[model samples]
Target: MSEGAATAATVATAAGTAPLRERNGGQILVEQLRIQGVKRVFLVPGESYLPCIDALHDHQDAIQPIVCRQESGAGYMAEAHGKLTGEPGICFVTRGPGATNASIAVHTAYQDSTPMILFVGQVGNDFAEREAFQEIDYRRMFGQMAKWVAQIDRTERIPEFIARAFAVATSGRPGPVVLALPEDTLWGKASVPDMPRYQRARSAPAPAALDALQTLLAGARRPFLLVGGSGWTAAALRDLETFAERFDLPVGVAWRRLECFDNHHANYAGHVGWGMDDALRARIRDADLLIAVGTRMGEATTEGYTLVQSPLPRQTLVHVYPDAGELGRVFRAELPIAADVVSFAAAAAALRPAAEPAWRGLARAAHAGFLAHQQARPAPGPLNLDRAACVVRERLPRDACLTVGAGNYALFPHTYYRFQGPGTSLAPTVGSMGYGLPAAISAKLEYPQRTVVCYAGDGCFQMNLQELGVAMQYRLGIVLLVFNNGMWGTIRAHQEREFPGRTIALEFDNPDFAALVRAYRGHGEVVQSDAEFGPALERALAFAQEHSLPALIEMRYEADGIAPGQTLSGIRAAALAQRAPAAVP
Candidate 1:
């Protein structure tokens, strides 16, 4: 597969003006990716995609493939890449086992609205109905999670499929797409012209819709802005901030979307997700006008549809999104504007407020509540996870990237740290547990100079801990802080709340994570108290930066201290008291 062959073959095909050359499906697919500006690919090698790997060997100038330790890790790295870049993070895996392993990140991408593409190497076409080894119908398996799923049969259609994959993955309500490549099809050859690169189709808000939004705001006593989901450009975020500043509207970021807005902004409110501050939640519930942009207002953000009622919210709702289908799917909107973030934000910035905002005090109070929420008190443990989060925020540069997987521990960083934009945060809104480590690795790989830190719980870290080997292999100097409490904190809190002391499979013992990091040929440390943390962190960062290797600090904490200002035993005691006959009433 040489460019010279493509150029020298001047015999144009009968159907087109451009010359066509005999190229295998793998070569064509890779070339098409090159034309689409794919700089890197994440994958775990398999025999099914051997031809593609062979093509990669010759076309090294086009794309750099990062080999991962497991299919899941590869998929996660790709998902993180997508979150950071707003492009389709590409992943390649083999048939059944590989595809199944990679499905976790695919689900995260789907729920988080990140653009990504997963390429699975399928069985030969000859074995279509025989249920061959390592074979599964991806179209059926990934149909629900992915925006589109299909298999490439004819080699000639490779370019067409690739182009459409990019377009669909980046279009409205951007999500993951799956494309399966049959082994036989990839090995076959065809003389065909390449399809041009795909561009994201943008939709702007109609003028009347903008007018209705301004009218709604003008009439309201209180209005709020909630931003999240995906397909957001930096310019869009700037314009959104401009709109908020002009209207003096309170802005709250959706779950795991700290990147959506600058936390330091005066109009910024507290995090609007699970375990949100009571003050902010009440403010949202009481707002007269709610302008929700980009976010789908999922269960986490809406507190199980209680904050803003489904079907018909009590507050007048102005929903803005790239896709129209999601506008009325759950909550009916007074004004539904189907426009991409870029366009909607631009329009919003340009619109003149009908009057001076009546909700200035409300916005100021919301920002105050957000600031107060960041202040952490002592927990029932030696290690102050919240203080450690503050340490990372203070010591690291404002541009440093922070990654966290889902756990009770994640709440600390979500609460304490201030995010600048997309470059600073990598978290899974769908609450996937093993996302942090790989996401940190991906961030470091993408931005080698930026400081990268990962926060994970004992249970969450163990889920994809083996990926440490991949980080060590790549010499990615990422610092990891493992909050070890010997239990899955989130479930323990819930279990204590519902059943008191009946803890079952949720409790588990963990290995020495510091030793595990050492075994992986990276720097390691143990910090159990507040005094040991700062010094240990400094050492870890110094080691990682100087040695160009990963570093881990195992910060041990008490199991009873489940969350900030919350204890498991206290919860159990409260539950038991509630269960014991309600005062004979």
Candidate 2:
């Protein structure tokens, strides 16, 4: 798209006026963002950003600023937006403490390859050495975590730099970029030259590469594909499945992949990590050919980064990612292709490969074994996390979006729920709390038609429950299911298992979540016993559907010190023995 056409028509409107009126740099920044196709900007209100807030309010129609409860939640919400739409999500916060507050989500976005632009309002331009209130060198503070970190000290550079920030954020190796704008500069008057939007060029595989890939697929005794990240769209997923089926290849999703394919598909071998059965783990070791797309093969999926050392030596690993760095960064790859996921898959789909029925059969058997294992060890009573996850999965609308919070409790949905479409589930691979509520809000904001459900533990939910008001304010019909297990279940379990009788700050309590939800003018319901689980979910969904607002469902299960990291069911049963009944009012 031409630079002029890339930006919206407002620039043209501004230019046609013979009488030019200079506006605040902040307003110019908002206009530039709006022209660049930013539909929403998530933020936490702060004194330092008053000028930017005013400017945003002035241009509210062109760009919407979503007020979040916490700065971190705002960043997560932005990251989720970017995950949903293949665009750079925008998050604005104040300097120093505000930037620090949002650091976790920024790191989450960085690690997950979720494109986001975090604009932090800094101290006055002349106050750097003064150690003023909330003043800190943001570039230094956020340098390590962000892809690119810069401070905007001059008003004239706002438009061009910000436009570049968006481009860098959404480009290869997509990640969160930081822009620290000084408060004084934001209020300064400047005429920003019209900046246009930018779109990345799609990549295509070379004919030689395609030929090699096809030959490898045809000759391999056991070929497999691993899907990861939210880079693929539904159409791309379909094409991938078609290509896999044509070659009769097995498929396993990377750990916490957003959505790759239907788990019920006969050839699905299950996720690579997060406690898969021995059969699937063995399949990874034995597979002769492995083709990975849009995945980093991060530590979690690599069996705690042991793919190189332990039981699995490694196979012919082929990686395709938009980022060149991720190609061979993790597990060394036999063939690494740098290209956009959908385009690369499309290119691969055009190639022809010989069918391997034996490979297909092995894949089918592995899937069958995994399914049987799951069926035998069903989630049990006292509000079984696995069973509850299954129930939630059943209750979710077709193609519903799921957002998982941090903590062992989040493993409930991460392990149990199967996402059939791309971008259906969002969770921070970094495993940070306070991600769910904001992510849900962002999902709902982006895809209003789809049901967005957030799964959070009590400890995690408390980290950002205030976003409930943001949901209500936006009239976002998202459902929040809080796994209210009292204390920090994950840490407690660690204490119980590793250092028994040494629980310290992990033991803490909270206000009644249901009542708190009502106080925020949203619906709240408590599920005190196992019997109320199903009913509570139904009512929560109904309330969201009826009111067109967020609903909080606090399912009070016995924490029992069961940590999500425990791989065995026996561990969970043993953990349950340590519970003391605590009911939510």
Candidate 3:
């Protein structure tokens, strides 16, 4: 026996008649996860890792295993968990097809800067190079998509690999890590000590950097504060709030990062991203200084990198990020501070602002623009998304978590919904559809006390609707609002603009969404008109709470209601006018 095994045996023997327990790599892996304070794991069951599932059975009381219908849904749930808890979300899947299916969530984690760990069961070591059943090189497949990828060939190394996985996943510029486990190795016996919980190294801005930032802020006439990315704690958000208020800085959240700041704050500017308000774009364009905190200022956040010029932005840019490597990678920064969000915010809060600048008028104007843009416009159809957003904002609890997948339907919540605080919004920055339902499930599981709502489009919801079974099985009380326009609204809107009445493969004869939910033994409702939404939402919320199961509400709208302040017909007309032949003269 190995020395580690002998020592474990001796300890067991000393406990008077307690038999020495022989453990496999699977058992060790689960135990290590428990030691790392992982309370849950999302997974899709497979025979490739039967031993892991069996081991999970023993640790069910300590670590709840949520079985999802599809690997993609499981991965999305894990990603959402990571976003909410600031730890590596855990997901397990089988080899080949399962791993490929779960890659979407891995990509989302990479782009969104959320920490996650994906474990894939592999073929036996003997079959690895033979291209045997369900065999694939995970390292090559996930090389560009993940921060780190490795395969464990020995049972004894499980502890070391798992500990490193957690550390790497949560470290600077957090992202997903992929670990492959061979079936035979998982079944092998080994004694290994579990590592303690992992902690990320925090970085603080240098005194010089802070002084430079203060000087810049003191001189700026119109400074804009942009906040985004993960690695945020409640304390960090509180510090950011105080920092924004102290200087009356206009704060704008990056793409889908509204939860980073309180939207109702007096200094709040509108979010900067796709479908952003024109007024907010003007503010970004006219700003004399832009202080970006924790955000990478990626393509989406920068409106295809057009809002701020590349290499040298038109405005002076002060960029703060946890990773030094990310600093000045895209847009050149006049002052770069390599500090974590919380640390930088705390340091910035210490600086005394030069007597309230005469430029406070610009900040107030930005806030006014944000408020004006949030006011919903009248819809021509009975099913008005504007009204729905308002009703949800008024009805849902202030701390309720709202999740959305990609679609024009998401614009309503993005524009009108008020997130009272951090950790309240979970939307994919990568524009992945079908993310909302799984994320909502994970959010509800993480915070059962808070209400959870998922806003999905007809096409978006169907992408992972199979996960409803997971919700029903786990008894998660999440409310789903499906905007049913019988078409891929965003795609159709684009086609109308570009093709000018040439539409193809955009419409769908969808399943009865409400009936589909009911088939899963959950409550379902159909709201066809504006007046029906409030009562339907109340019923859905009450049903979710009473049954402890997900409730679905299918909201029907006319095809012309493509998006806020835009319609399919209007787009087609404008496109035709642009393409029409001019008179000879």
Candidate 4:
């Protein structure tokens, strides 16, 4: 046959209707998500979700299914994807243990304000009253954390319910949405409606609030800006950068929101709390007006509920948030506006007045000082936390995404790396371990074009070590760098310093991480000596490219016996001083 004839025949075959009916419940649910622009779905398998899995396979071109090892890991990966793409991350899991395991990531998304959709399989109608295997009330259990939760009892309601769930999840106060798909209903048949596509809702800031913010900006002798969280869109970030530059105002990023601005920006003043330098902090304290956008300015970000030693007596705080409850929940605010972050920022930028010469000059000098301090900070030695960050930052592709687990190992990435894109880095601020590997694999699945790396410590990685097989099974090209300190470094630092010579149960005898990775049919290597670090990293990256599988690089470094901000001895001595009396002269 001629080439053209062969192409025509192939097109005819491919264009035919699906083998199954359009009324299939699982297919409808998947189609609803497709219409909403969701392209990836991460999951762990179980009997309850067999129907949903079948439907996902039926619509494979529209929604990609990423299988994971653990339910929590799947959720973490989905959260990371949502952060990166500004699209609702979809994840599927079975009921009971599966639902409970996935619940943690819901809280993670809620706290982070990440947009995600979780599809959980529930017991069949026949087993609901009999306590069927792996069955639990996910709706009630996840209600507190999710923006929306529903159990689909009928196949016909799948389209409407899921469309509503996405709207609620991605609208104001974006967070996780849970949808429970009953197994029997998924297998059952009904007419699937072609629901209207989901559209994100954005509201403009209130006129009164906009006028009030403008008035403050025009009248202030010293004004500051605090940017926080992932709610701000790229255009909003650009507007903020421009506004700060135009007015010469020093901007303070919320603690752990390094991705909000380039660390090298001239108008940047370091973080508001959590190891922020005293000098820059003092400068922020002196500001007469504070503009907070898209951030709760919560306890952790405020350094245990205090921005300064004492609240600025005359400072006017204008907080802008998507959630009404988060406003003025921590500190008193002169003006609290409930509006979409990006829209509000755009409006504020348009109305902002020109900066006075004197105030602009002061802010310029403050920004310069901040840059000097950043440069003056010492680098961690080879095999140290700083070196690991430096290597990855310099060598990794500019667009690569990273997943970092909670521990001392995470501190370096938080403090050292500068993120240029949204969702460039993923980590649980509430301090959850065992998230790094799974999140990395999830990122890779969501964005196959970019490199993905997960930074984890010995103790943290051990908690979810089984995920390595998931990486192999899917042929995920992720790089896993294990910081092998052989102890729960954060807690150990405290115990060693506070209780000198006292052995605590915080230490661990680590398995050979390299051997474990190799056992899973992936490349593995150890970097213990200074000279071997560069070579080992090169080999690992090469392995990732050659085999298109996960690569594990175990890096060993000497324990500095120090916490992130204080020495172990310093903490212990502080405790001792509080307990002991001064010597009598």
Candidate 5:
């Protein structure tokens, strides 16, 4: 037979068979993962999961394993991978301490609505419930942290549990799931058929709902669009942009969800969360119609549920979410639409908007306010954060991924940098510190061509600083930007506000981060001024690109620059004035 005919015959023959084969439970689990298109698994090897690790020996070409320095770092990388790919990022860890360490990322994935699966190795089935070595009840431990948690003791049901884990993780309001594998069960032999790739179910808005939304939009004077949450595809983002532009609606994202909308878009308003713009907050509070899409309007986004009052909002609220349970769980919406964000956006894009929206000027004003606030003013001290932020904005790639942990220093990039599109900014909305560096590593590993920058505070950087080894080992280029202010800036700022100079345990001495990265055989530099930052960043980026290794640049600043607009001394003065005796009353 000719080459074409021979190829067709081979395909026909292969399709006729089930491709089933006898294998150990561990091998069968690996085969199922391979079938699901998993490219990598982040892990810290332990003895309990040796069989699975051994099974991985034969599939090196199929799935690459990322050996991390710690379980938290590994889990963070996995969570970041999930956020970037919209797939269930896989992570494996041993029981007890390993599981506890990984819980940080599990909670992050849960709160951030990212899809991830954490497979924890458990004690052998023979040691069940006897408080054996490194044994912990995973179901009880991870019940609140994970979307679903279960232990698989039966070798025959490996495929079933793994498939269901993926389904539960990627389904409604995508989040993390946990599966525990007993050592003995993983070593047992089993013959199981692999599951096909899981597909997420997309729910679209009803025609009546769309009509009602249109009616609400047509009559509104000041309408604002709040978009957030995960599970957004590129096409969905495009649809969202189209809907916003067509309706001349001002768009604001919830908390750290700047990735939900292009910050450069004409309709883009400021982020609505902690350290949010006062003008944007006013706009959100005063809007006649508020359309919340995808987001849960969590505490941060809602300003502790003060922006949109609970039970009943001051403005007419239209809430849309993927999970039906979350629609009216908090604030009762005027129109609650339980549909996938992407599907709803696609359907909303098809609606015809009013030829002359009454609130066109309101959208323009909102966008103008956002643009105005992005221009950072001169800050105190020699190392001006405003200038540094401006340098990053002007020098870095528009689509470069910027990750940040919780700190007052984050306000600079949060206000100054403009995210060009979705999935470019990875920040922890739940205020998880030390997420930036690990997330940057994962971003680079997933998209090697894209530039990944981690903006971390002195305290935040040290939280997962050991992950630099992981980057070096894998040859992934990522830039670490450390903002060294010589204290816990956010806590200090709050202390200054509340106690008026009673700063106690907030201050601490930090190591030379530049020297720290250099100790790891990575490029390092110190930038003392605004002019020094550009050259240092350029050198770091060039070094990372040329060597395919991690780079760190430490920018030194004073403690008085607690935040962009407020100084520590100013806060103290205000507090003291508030406490001063009122004419011996």
Candidate 6:
């Protein structure tokens, strides 16, 4: 197991296949990744994972290792890769602190249903149970969040475990997996054969289920289609859209999954999440038959389960999901189909209504309502976010990719921007802040041709702002829009609604963000008013493209304007009016 050149051998695995190669565990793991066509890996280097880092050096041509600022940033980047490609995004971090820091992304991936694999460098076997330096039982730490969690115990078992990780990550409810690499096993050497690349498995609806769905649709006067979740192919999305069009069905993209369907289509209903219009909410609530595809109809999409009741929904629910466990986990469905999105969409597309849908006008009305909701509204500030968002929608290409972290500013993108379809947008369903920048970096690296825009609030942007250095080093031309309201905007709005003018620990002063980006050798600017926003954004976009660097625009608006058409003063006044007089108490 010396650092010398590895030797090749002809030993075969149980199944008998390729010739075995003698190399360290690190080399075997990395080779398996390369064989699986892994082109990129995100990592925050640590001594714990030095062996794997060295192995990555030899395979530089086949795999690109991106060194990020922090483990969380690396994890976020990896998670974004998973969302964009529908493959297991690879991330490497150290044990203990590193693994703990990256847990947020793991949680996000688990909830978002994105396929990702996080590899943590662990202490050697000899140090087991002795509380070695930076030692942690990742299985115990990540068991609840990750789909699967285990450690590599020996060099010879590397291929077996690696193969399983990929399969587990991409299976049924595609999710995150954690594999801890003990240092002793990683540095040890053995002659072992690599496992074959893993194949993804999917479930399809039964013929009877298809017939049942059509029968239900035939008897319904109003039917609505809801779509979201991971493992969606462009062709599958096309099929789903065709199914909706053929059925004249109003379709609501679930929660932050705005990219699940074309926003401009006539059958396109409004986004089914926070800030959704009343008409769209009514459509989801009042529809006689609710056909949910892919999405779980999580709390956010269901508005805390008021729109679609759980256990027993008011509407006739036809839930289509890949995992059988999720079929009846919550809401009771009239027809529960266990099928992947692609499979269900393909079959659903071929179905013809028994008669013309009774609600063609319903679909058209929903789309019209969605379009009308996008119009700009007056706010209390000179810097209106709706206007700025409209400018971005008009300027950027239709296929541009937009990423957003959590904050009140998220409403702007979720409400205003028109996502072309799947792969055109990235946002956390679990509401994780600090995701926009890292996700944008991953998107820019993956596509390179399309425009990538990241929208974040002041608080959200600062969470992993250090990752801006990674974008600069990689020369990714990404346009970042920071909505700087000089406070934790979302929290401040909540405080105003509940406590009404009694706010604390919410407001904070900010550094000159433009100056910070300029220090990284990237373009930066600030816009203080509506008139300045368009010009600043134009310059930032041009500079990023021309210089092959990141460009950041800081839009500083009135702190009074927490969200679109909602001001702190207005919220406070309304709260005060609703409260009983202090004298009565």
Task: Give per-model TM-scores.
Answer: 0.97, 0.89, 0.96, 0.89, 0.96, 0.97
Determine the C-alpha RMSD for candidate 1 after optimal superposition of all C-alphas.
Answer: 2.5
Count residue pairs with overlapping backbones in model 6.
Answer: 0
Per-residue lDDT of candidate 2, residues 145-194 (tens digit): 98999988887678888888888887777888998888888887764466
In candidate 2, which residue pairs get closer than 3 Å at backbone N, Cα or C atoms, i.e. clash?
none
lDDT of each residue in 232-315, candidate 4, tens digit only: 667888878877877778887786666676556778777667667777777767778888788777666777766632233246
Residue 376 deviation, candidate 1, in Å? Answer: 1.7
Q: Which whole-number lDDT from 0 to 100 does residue 473 have in model 3?
A: 90
TM-score for candidate 6, residues paired by index: 0.97
Put down candidate 6 lDDT per residue, 18-80, tens digits, no spaces: 655578888989999998779999999988878789999999999999999999999999999
Clashes of each: 0, 0, 0, 2, 0, 0
Error of 4 at 554 (Å): 1.6
**Each model's lDDT:** 0.89, 0.77, 0.90, 0.76, 0.89, 0.91
lDDT for 245 in candidate 2 is 71
> How much is the lDDT of residue 152 in candidate 4?
91
Q: Alpha carbon lDDT of residue 352, candidate 4?
A: 50
Per-residue lDDT over 314-366 for candidate 1, one digit per residue giving the tens place of the 0 to 100 score = 99999998989998999999999999888899999997786777776877888
- In Å, residue 175's CA in model 6 sits off its true spot by 0.4
Q: Distance (Å) between predicted and true CA of 352, model 3?
A: 1.1
Candidate 6: residue 194 Cα off by (Å) = 1.0
> After TM-score superposition, what is the CA distance of residue 199 in candidate 1 from its true location, in Å?
0.9
RMSD in Å for model 2: 6.4
What would the TM-score be for candidate 4 when compared with the true structure?
Answer: 0.89
